[model samples]
Target: MKSFSDKLLWGIIVLLAAAMAITAAVKLSPLLNPPQDISLPLNAACDLHQGPCTTSLPGGGRLEFSLEPRPIPVLRPLRLQVRATGIKADSVEVDFAGVDMKMAFNRPRLVSGKEGLFTGEATLPVCVRNKMAWQATVLVEADGQRIAVPFRFETKR
Candidate 1:
């Protein structure tokens, strides 16, 4: 038969083991199950209006994103272009999202051109504020999987 002190010692060890496991699980939760919406980060200083910004894809490949009409006009037909390399893509799309506020759904499927170039057009809704921040998420679909690269830009009225 186990003595009382031995039983208490075993119980304490088991409780500590459980506590350590829980702590590890809590600390590593985000790394284990990353958020699904996470996309490739774009440089904060990058100016899509001035020129195209290029970023590497998750697995492999390079994506060049750009918005047209330097200064990025609002309520006017805006041109969007993306040049991607090193991946077989089924389709490409650009989803516009307002950073400061929620706006109507605006997603445009870009037409593929020669040599992995995709182009599309869209009109941005007028914002109440003079300057509005926006995020353009480029969605690339291939082999039943989708990859997104997000670019942030601001529009001035």
Candidate 2:
């Protein structure tokens, strides 16, 4: 026995409540389960062994990675230097893996050398193929959040 206006008011209230609920979910969903993998495209033509290569990071930061010994060699110690700008990181680590092969287990924690500079030593394993593609994933931890930046490069025998 509700009047027409009363029914219309109830309908509007229901719609408003539903809209608010959807908005809340959209805002809080990321916090509930933050993204784990964030793929960053190479903004520049980078030769990892030749010189320094830079990539843009989230939150207006820049990540630069350089490998020592101009041409990267397999089964040899390689020096990796990481430089970060405009971002504060508590710790940084590098994970090296084969791009097309199932080769893992090369995560090395870098030591801080100077302000915003991290250095570490890692070696690339030889693959069956004469030329192999590798990905170096740099994990930066700050403020209880982990950001992964991957850099892809190729090596030949």
- TM per candidate comes to 0.73, 0.71
The Cα RMSD of model 1 versus the native structure comes to 10.5
Residue-by-residue lDDT tens digits, candidate 1, 40-130 = 6666877888899998876678889888888899999998889989877778888888997998878889999988999999999999999
The parts of candidate 2 lying over 4 Å away from their true place are: 1-39, 42-44
What overall lDDT goes with each candidate model?
Answer: 0.84, 0.81
Residue 116 local lDDT, model 1? 90
The top-ranked prediction according to lDDT is: 1
* Residue pairs of candidate 2 with colliding backbone atoms: none
Q: What is the per-residue lDDT of model 2 for residues 1-157, given as tens digits with 9 covering 90 to 100?
A: 9999999999999999999999999998764434655656644467786688888887788888888776888888989889988888777888888888979577789998777999999998888899998888788776667877777788888
Clashing pairs in 1: none
